[model samples]
Target chain A: MLTQTVRMLGRLGETVVKGVAEMGFAAVLLGEALFWLAMGRRREQPVRLAPIVAEMTEIGLRALPIVTVLAVTIGIMLAIQGIYTLRMFGAESQVVPGIAFSVVREFAPLITGILVAGRSGSALAARLGTMRINQEVDALQVMGISPVRFLVVPPLVAMLVMVPSLSLWSILVALGGAGVYVSSTLDMTFAAYARQCLEMLTLGDLAHGMGKSFIFAVLITLVGVVNGASVSGGAEGVGRMTTRSVVQAISAIVITDMIFVFLVTR
Target chain B: MNGVDRTSSRVAIEVRDLVTHYGERKILKGVSFDILEGEILVIMGGSGSGKSTLLNHLLGLLRPTSGAIRLLGVDITKAPPREMQALRRKMGVAFQGGALFSSMSVGDNIMLPLREHTRLDRKTMEIMARLKMEVVDLAGFENLMPAELSGGMIKRAALARAIVMDPKLLFCDEPSAGLDPVVASSIDDLILRLRDAMGMTIVVVTHELESAFKIADRILVLDKGEIIGLGSVDEIRNSASERIQNLLHRRTEEVELDADAYLRRLTGEE
Candidate 1:
């Protein structure tokens, strides 16, 4: 019994140590990526533009349909809930501002981050993980190309440019959904709904959501790249890392979102 | 020539007391050797004999646990990233499985090194890639993806990519592992032709005795993470060592297992 307890504790300690080491490695990788982005510019060695545009199309442009559908659904659900509560005090007009505030300042960025994490993050991990397993990453290294600069930078740049754009698009779609709901259910016009939404949404609110999204974009791409680059074993390993990348990216997005909400709201 | 005469030749790779470990298990145990310039050195080993590990160290992909690896006059074992990159530009590696990027066409794959390292125009790069494809007898197959090619074609395309830059040093891992005898012999012939034509030092890691004997100027035999023999093909074939004889004759080592140990192994008792 004593041996069993000690062994369990030993395993727990090993896991903790491994986790810390992985996090340290990830931090170093992020630092190298940032260094390249900042310093590689002045050296006249910008990462190729073709892959960045391709990645943007994959991660952002292709994600519009799903993001639009999800944002609209969330907006309708929020309107239904908010109206039910507001009508109790004859404050149906308050529903528009309430839904708009939540959608613009919180849900839009959070949902878009999570969705992009599931879509693009998993793809980046699986693709890179396969490359790692196939020894193609080593091939790149032996060819005098830094795998980080070649593989990671394009996706990183794409996410940085596209995630915030997706978030803003989600906000507009959600507002449109809420406006439709307001026009049909209550005695409010779409123009009135738009006016209330605009009044409640300050530049601070937009920045707040976008800032969270930009950070989440960085997190998702880094987590994917790190997990992907570290894959071993075989095809099974690639699958395992892809799953881990998606789960970790979504969890990090949520945790970062919470922290941003706390700090920005305060 | 004797060991002294071989060592006197222009040294391309100088490994001394090289040791490597994967975690707690030592994969290479104090192995030492020299690869002469402009010669094909075949590293022959059975499974799990640290051949791949040593190749990784030579390529500067993995650092050794101890000792040094000097490639083309630079101590790559201790070289920084920039220096390593600069040194790597002078070398090329064709991996065991070809390692071609699946997404790219054969032409694009061959052009990758030139595109990354040289300021050659796209047309020039394409023409150069086509020239290499022709050298490998893979001409007119540039538009196909790696998955679309046969096992031999993929290997030939990978060879084309490796030689696209006309590197000073070339490393090939298991160049004839998964192919028919005819295709394998063609690959062997290609290796010889490339060495003669380009005048580059080549290190090939393979377990195929016929291929090793055919193309190698010297054969280094590795067994259980140690160099058991290093000599010319004739010297290795004429070796009196039972291990060398067994490897050449395809004889398996017999093991006498203790009953208790066997039971323990079967029962997961270690």
Candidate 2:
């Protein structure tokens, strides 16, 4: 029993390490691709651009309402907690900066990315994974289409374009909701909270958070694509990989968020 | 077996010493066959005998480990993606489960390859889709989702999708595996009609002996990744090979009466 437990723990540790490594690799690959795009590696292909645009519209634009609503709700809940905790120390004014920084820098993007991971990322993984299992990937290959170009490239390009936009919207809604909370509960003026938000958050904070969002996007997309491409066996295999991708994506977002915080603080 | 395959044969697909593996288990073991143009080649085997694997290799769905696959005299093993695409445009495949895209309407599924591979406008694509649907006698069922259709309808829809590109070669895997006898036979008849009209080379993989005999221009029996027999239906029927005979004359699970004892009891002359 002791040996089994030890073995289980060892396996768990190895999986976590491997998961982190895969996430790092995915980020590096996306970063390299982004750099390539910057360096004019992306040639003019109007026909290929259409599908990527469609995917961006689907994964990014169509996802706004749900993401905004979820973020606002989280902001309200954070506002309540911020107010309650600040009141205990008689530091009600700090609640403004607290909610502002938390939402813009960490909470909004993290929560929104997690939500999208569970919703959109899982769907992408399942779609591609099932396609892989059902021989559709092979069918695509037989038809002389690279599954990577047809499937992976579209989603990767879409997520890279969408996540930051979604993150920005989430930040706006979260700040707006927190401002309402401040105006009502803390007896603070709306302008005062707005000014405080502007003063407390810097371009660096925005960049840091958006940077994390980009990483999250790449992580989710990569996990989805890799899990999908690696899919074999059958339905159960697809299911397993989809679950793994979503879980891995969300966990990576959290871990990377921590790393971002540590690096920014340092 | 020699240098030149019969030029008189009008070869459509020729696979030479095809070997394929799935992980550790070798699925196809140096299997080779050629399909003549405008003839139905029915591949028969028990479960896991690599019939489906061979079909996949022929269709270019799976790469062979070591073999030459020639389609219409072009070596597909070395064909570029564009060339393979051009080759695939001339062929169609109906998979085992009628793998119509679950996310699309039947009409959309039929029109997908056309839209992707051709520069046709939406109107022309729709017309083409409708024409294929009409050919499959599924004209009005275009708007139905795959999930909304019955098994036989799904099969017909899949067939419509396969032939929408006007393929010269139709590769169907287990065309009648899950359907009832009447529906299966109807599908078989449709295949025959399609072959007759299109002068298409049809390759069907099936273990259904009756279905095989019904539709086969020639049959190849596979066992343990080896071709046990390859001949016309009549040739297979008259084969003196014990394995072939045993397979053809399948013994039922129930006990049979003793012929001499029964005859003596009935007529007092054994």
Q: Highest lDDT, which number?
A: 1
Specify the highest-DockQ model's number. 1
lDDT of 1 by residue, B1-270 (tens): 222245456998999999999999999999999888888999998989899999999998998899999998899988876778678878989999999999999999999999888789999999999999999999999999999999999889999999999998999999998899999999999999998888889999999999999999899999999999998999999999999998899899777879999999999758
**Candidate 1, Cα interface RMSD:** 1.7
In DockQ, how does model 1 score against the reference complex?
0.69
Q: What is the per-residue lDDT of model 1 for residues A63-157, given as tens digits with 9 covering 90 to 100?
A: 99999999999888889999999999999888987897899889999999999999999999999999998999999989987777788888999
TM-score of chain B of 1: 0.94
The residue-by-residue lDDT of candidate 2 on A21-111, one tens digit each, is 8657666656645543454223211136777888888898889889989888988988999989988999978888888888888988898
Clashes of each: 0, 0
Global CA lDDT of candidate 1, please?
0.91
Mark the regions of model 2 whose C-alpha exceeds 4 Å error after superposition.
Answer: A1-62, A80-90, A132-138, A229-238, A263-266, B1-7, B249-270
Clashing pairs in 2: none
